[model samples]
Target: MSDPIPSADPLDDLRALIRGAPGPDRGAVAAARARDAELTKPAGSLGRLEEIVEWLAAWQGRTPPAIHHPLVAVFAANHGVAERGVSAYPASVTKQMVANFAAGGAAINQICIAEDISLKVFELALDVPTPDITVADAFDRTGFVATVAFGMEAISGGIDLLCLGEMGIANTTVAAAVHYALYGGSAEDWVGRGTGVDDEGLARKRAAVEAAVARLDGERDGLEVLRHVGGREIAAMAGAILAARHQRIPVIVDGYVTTAAAAALHAIDPHAIDHCLFSHLSVEPGHRRVLERLGVKPLLDLGLRLGEGTGAALAAGIVKSAVRIHAGMATFSSAGVSERGVH
Candidate 1:
């Protein structure tokens, strides 16, 4: 056979990584299923919880999966699009919120504490906001790739489960633009009143999304679309997703902004995000469309639009419980319980 594709460019390397991701471990899945059959509860009574256990096993390549060290990583950045009045809050809010995360005062902190997951906040150059998407590309190729690499590094040490989220003013608008470019939808189909923007602000967001995509003139290469419209935090989240697949770590992706990041990778290859489980169904209208296109359902539907990884952390709690039940529950033999339908 001829030589495989070369990765002379960083974006080319990213494409290779996505395409080369390993598939689920069939042996691990079989082992998990065998154990599930021995549990005292009726077969499949645990519903998706049982499936979650198998999923964790298949991804972690182990018989019984456990969440010993789950992480909630939230990347924060400032978007130049915020200057267009697409969000109710100013760009300064991005930096302030990062501070809030650091001070342990944000909702994400409380959720992580309750769920026993560690939280890390990455602030991507608050002083250097991405270029306004309506007028220019969001990031040059080098900077974008570097940011992605930084995100990949976040999956270090002994993280078995990763929950990805973002904090960026006007990133929802950036996400809408990227979605429209990648998915060929109208601006309204992707735009939502993020951060409680009023009617006029919503109109501005739609127009900004429209203008940003129109500037692309139909450029739909996943990385190219991201380079043109995706923000730093979005790129980082995408990188985290990619890295999680390579490391065999299961990921719980947060709401719209984070989902849009995964959607970019999904556009590159339909199965690029197979390792990621969406955390929740955001009230944001675009999120449902993205999930439908990806052919996956969220773990919860608390009408959450907050973007600090709260939804993903909550989902992590459920995943933790699933693993606990699968590993901790007594087996039929051990408990001396009679099997169902035994004569």
Candidate 2:
């Protein structure tokens, strides 16, 4: 399954980079933390901001890191399970929302505009959806490779912070299935009311996820689990996270669906987690379990369940401000202020 060249196999390239990806620069992290202590504000006064700055420094391999150009990629794809009434909205909404995102009409578009961050929607096409996870592999190998490459190409140069988002109907079901596959659990433990599914719909969603989890018999440590339960967009987000870490760009993971991709990516390479910042802990029941397993804390918790990278865009500003403060603020020595506890 490992192809040496990109032409032979695309997924191989991703796997290759992820396997070889280096750990974050510890020297940069130490220097950034040292700088944070010298800031005019009290040590650790900025709370998460201080941690964010250090994260940016280590990921970018530089101290005083700055979020020069923030970019959010909203990977959109359809799920075959959606045809089974898991989501409240029709599957057509996935394609329609992609147009809305393109036309600058969605909430994420407006958020990107307000924050001055670029936004792009990667619609994996509505005509061809991933197979139902309950029966067959959710994604084709070739298409999965293409989606990952597409995500990598979307990320060009001059990108400081990478925010990952998704737009797919019934994706929470897909996410829950992957979650259950990754970590053994009951359907009730992983399922959530995605898109505000009614009681009966939620029950159906859990049943579908449970069935999907039961169908897995492949190698647990390989990509078989993801291929069986992950959608193209989810695969692409995993690729993007891998690509971001391969490039040493710090990535901000959105909500449950995005975190699911992060989870899948982490399964492949635990080292990649060092570059990821969980934007928020989603209300989705399974998200907390994933976050806990990863041992990473979410930056914000505004009860955000909307999945158009809204949580990511909202967190992007805070991350940027952290860098700006770390880079632009004067030290107490420069400000001519007496050091704390100086007799």
The candidate scoring highest on lDDT is: 1
Model 2's alpha-carbon lDDT is: 0.84
TM-score of each: 0.97, 0.93
Q: Which portions of model 1 show Cα errors greater than 4 Å?
A: 1-6, 341-343
Question: What is the C-alpha lDDT profile of model 2 across 1-343, one tens digit per residue?
Answer: 8754454655566667777887888999999988887878777778888888888999999887877788999999899999788999999999999989988899999889888899977788777888888888886777667777777777777798899999999999999988888887688888999899999999999999988878885345435677788888888888788778768899999999998888876777777668988998899988889899888989888888889999999999898888878889988889897767432
lDDT for residue 7 in candidate 2, whole number 0-100:
45
List model 1 lDDT by residue over 221-324, tens digit each: 89989999999999999899999999999999999999988999998888888888888999999999989988999999999999999999999999999999
Q: Considering summed lDDT, which 10 consecutive residues are worst modelled in model 2?
A: 217-226
Residue pairs that clash (backbone atoms under 3 angstroms), model 1: none
